[model samples]
Each structure stands twice: as structure tokens, then as C-alpha cells.
Target: MSANTDSQLAKRTDMKLFSGEKLLVIVSLIGFALAAGIAVYISIYGAIILPEGNAESAFSFNAAMGMFILSIAAILPVSGLSPGKRASVRWFFIVAALYSYAVETIQHLRGINPRFSQVGTVVDQIAGGLFGVIALLIVIATALFAIPFFRKRQPGERPLLVLGIRYAFVSTMIAHAAGIWMIVLQSRYTGEAGNLIVLHGLGFHALQALPVLGWLLERSRTDEKRTRQLIHTGGIAWTLAIILIGLQTALARSVFELAMLPFLAGALLLVWLVTVVIAAVGLLKIRKGSMVQTNTVSGEENRDLV
Candidate 1:
């Protein structure tokens, strides 16, 4: 009985795209698309259609957030899973996402922006703290699952996809923390909450962007080793960029408004650039060595044949 069960499990493991995977993927894609569309629509038509002080606009924004959060929760279980592999962490993401949505909903309904709320001045502070802690936990979980790939890749895991997920999670974590801190500590600091909230949104949405990039790269038929390297570099660079943005906002500055911390943001970008150059050079050297080895093997085979 044990042997039969083991054999069946092995067969399932070998199969790709198990039942519901395709559907889940589709749902994820739709959710991402809707989120993007809503964002754009709000940006362009927001002032006119759902102008500030409009209760309807607040409701609309909260509704969109609910949809976005639900979509994210749906994908969380499937994001790291490969065929037949038991989910390592599922309920954590779901609970976190749901709790975050609930808190945000309350704040939105109250017409108080979570990021702009003063310390102890409003109920939004409570919501921000709760949601911020959850986001931080998700970030930690993502790092534990992702950052170790510096040495080797996991079984049934596409290193690139995992890296993307990790990048997005970390970005969201930093954004959340920064927002909560502003509310709790820097309420007197009078830079617009829009800057901080924008950073948070960018980081949170990386979950969609990176995974989509991975899918496109695969479809492009790029070399596997190169693809992995590209994804790794991109993920790292992207995460660093977001972190830099978070730092700037934490300092009460807008994105790219680095006059407040003149050299810091540029220095972060420079560091990322240097890291990318180093990675590219290393990849070139490895590829060169591989070519030399292959040519040497071919010559040896030819001499033996002669």
C-alpha cells in the first residue's frame, strides 16, 4: 500500500499544470489587469469622477482595494507551488491580505488616509499598525523562502519567479512599515501622504509585475541560464530601487526629490548598477569557460577518431 501511494505521488509530481493551476493563473492575470486599469482610471479621472471629499470616491477606491487584495490572496497559495508539492505557506498570506483589506476599508470609510494619520490622533493609526505588522511578517516569510537562493535553487521552483515574488513582498513590507511609522512617529512632518502612499502602492504591485515578466521571458525562449541571471539581477535591482524610494519617503521627501537626502538615493541606484555590471561580467566569464571546455572536448574526440 505504501509503495502504491508513493508511486502515485511521484506520478503527480511529474505532471505539470495540475487541475486548477490554469484557472488560478488566469484569475491572477485578470486580477492584475483589473488593478492596473483601476489605477490608471483613478489617476486620470479621479479628480473629476471621484473627486476628494466625495464619499462615493472613497467607496470606489476601497472596493477596488478589496478586489485587488482578494486577487492577491487567491494567487498566494499557487505562486510558490509546483505540481504535487504541498503548500509551505498558504494561510499566512490569506489572513494577512484579508486583515490588511479590512483595516484599509475602515480607514477609507473614515475618510482618513492611513499614511497621513497623526500619532494617536485617529483610529486609522490602529489600522495602520495592524496592517503594517502583517505586511512586515509577509516580507519576512518571503525573504526566508527567497533570499537563500544565493547558493542554490529549490526543487520545483523557478528561481526567477521566486525572486520576483520575494522582491514584491519585500517592497510591500518596506512601504507598509514606512507608512505606519509616518503615522505613528512623523505625524508632524508635513510632506504629502501621497508620496508615501505612492511608494507603498508601487512596491505592493511588484508581485504582479515580476511574475508577469518571468512568464514573458519564458515565452521569449531566452537561454535558461541567462534567463535566471537576468531575473535575479532584475529582482535585486528592483527591490533595491523600491527600498531607496521607501527611504526617501520616510525622510518626508517625495520620490526622486532627493534634495532632502542628496547623495543617498543616487548612491543606491549607483550601487545597483555596479552590482549588475559585476553579475554580467561574471556570467560572461563563466560562459567563456564553458565554451572553452566544450571546444577542448570536441578536439579530443576528433583526435581519437583520427
Candidate 2:
């Protein structure tokens, strides 16, 4: 019965996505749903695992719920997006979501907690990684794929407010990805997991840099060089952050500090989080004053033989 209902629901969803005039709408809806689901999972997990009085636990529960609400609010508008943006960007989001799923599944199987070395910490890390991955995947795939696609397809399709809506979505995605890196760091002490952790961490956050390009794509339209520059700069920053993390993990000599190598990792996590916010907000500011305008020649109505 459940399987049948799920299939039916999926069919309904496909119909809505395929038949809908605006692909962006479908993209937004999917992204929104994905984000909301992550938030719920996190809130539940925190309530169950962490003690009632833990600040991180309580804050995460609150944060997840707040983010879930924000996702729904962001998804409300699906009417004004272009078709090209819809399919390409949406596909990117779906792929990213799938990739994150794979990453989390692997983590669950192999993820460890040096602090406890017990089943409880292992379970917490696995669950947390799973929940965090979904949120990061949706946010990034949408911005990196969908936003740029939309900007190109209908360069002047919507107003500044609309563009800002797009940036807000992207910003949230970067923030979530940055947060997930904290989970990645948990597994870094293991020599075997170190490389994988750093690789995935950088790869995931690399998507964050892509948004600066997406925002630029919206403004310059065809200035591929400028877009490339933004993406390149973002890539450099992304790589450096990963290097900082990798060096910290690889070079640490002692187990130290309650068995949880705290010195460098904690500092790097803080740096990563701060930059993530800065990048998100920077894109938002660059998109300021972007108005919707159509292109038309001043005096060429009936004849066109240029």
C-alpha cells in the first residue's frame, strides 16, 4: 500500500514538473522540499541524541526548523523562470543531491568519532552527515546549475527582487555546505579517512564558489570571461581552505585534548564558516540594483536588413 501510494505521488509530481510552464518553479519546489526534509531530520536527531541542555543541540534543532521554514518561503514563486534554466539547473541539483547521498552513505559505513570510539558517537556522526548532506546538495546544485542556466536563457526575465531571491537560495546553500564540513572534520584524524575527508570537503565547498559565477552570469549575461574569473577566484579560495584543513589533520602528532584533535581543526572550521557567509553575502550585494529590462532597437519596427 505504501509503495503504491509513493509511486502514485511520484507520478503526480512528474506530471506537475513536466507539464508546468515554468521549470524554475519545479526546481524551486524540489529544492525547497529537500531543504525542509533535512531540517526535520536534524531537529529530530538533536532532540533524541544530544542532552536536553546542550547549546549545540538546542541551537541545531532551532536552526533546522527555521531553515525548513525558510526553504518553503523561498519556493513559493515558480512562475517566472525560463525553460533552459529549469531543466539544466534542476538536473544539477538532483545530481548534487544524489552525490551527497552517496557521500553520507559511505560516511555512515566508515565514519568514526575519536572522542568516544563508541557506538553512540558513530551513530550521531552518521545521522548528522546524512542530514547535512541533503541540505548542502540541494542548495548548491540549484545555485551552480539552475541560476546560471536561468540567467542565460532569459537574461532580462525578472526584476532585482527576483534575482535576489535566487541569491538568497544560493547563499543558504553555501552556508549549509560549510556547516557539513564540520562533520567532515570529525573523520579527519584517521589516516585512511583524512584524504577522503579533505577531498569531499573541498569538492562540496567548491560548489560554493560557483555561485559568484552564477550571480555574475545574471549580470553580464554573455561575459564568459568575467564569469570565469569569479569562478576561478572562488576555486582558489576553496582549494586554500581545504589545504589548510588537510595540513592541520595530516601534520598533527598527538591525539590530544579529550581525544578530539581540537587545535587546528577548530580554527579551520571557524575560518571556513566565516568565509562561507562572506561569499554568500558578497554575491547578494553584487546583485544589487539589477532591474528587468527588454532589448529592442530604437527605430527598427518594420524592416530588418542590417
TM-scores vs. true structure, each candidate: 0.52, 0.32
Query: Considering summed lDDT, which 10 consecutive residues are worst modelled in model 2?
Result: 47-56
Candidate 2 off by > 4 Å: 1-209, 253-306
Candidate 1, TM-score vs. the true structure?
0.52
Model 1: how far residue 142 lies from native, Å: 5.9
Q: lDDT of candidate 2 vs native?
A: 0.42
lDDT of 1 by residue, 1-306 (tens): 688777665644443222333343443344445445545655765523311122333444344444445435434443544433324444454455456545544454444554445433545566666666775676576556444433354344444545555556666566556545545654424365326565656666665655545544444445778767766666666677777776676666666553634356456545545544545565567777889999999999999999
Strongest candidate by lDDT? 1
Weakest 10 consecutive residues of candidate 1 by summed lDDT: 47-56
Q: Model 2 over residues 39-90: C-alpha lDDT tens digits?
A: 5655675323322122233333333333333233233233234567555544
Collision pairs in model 1 = none
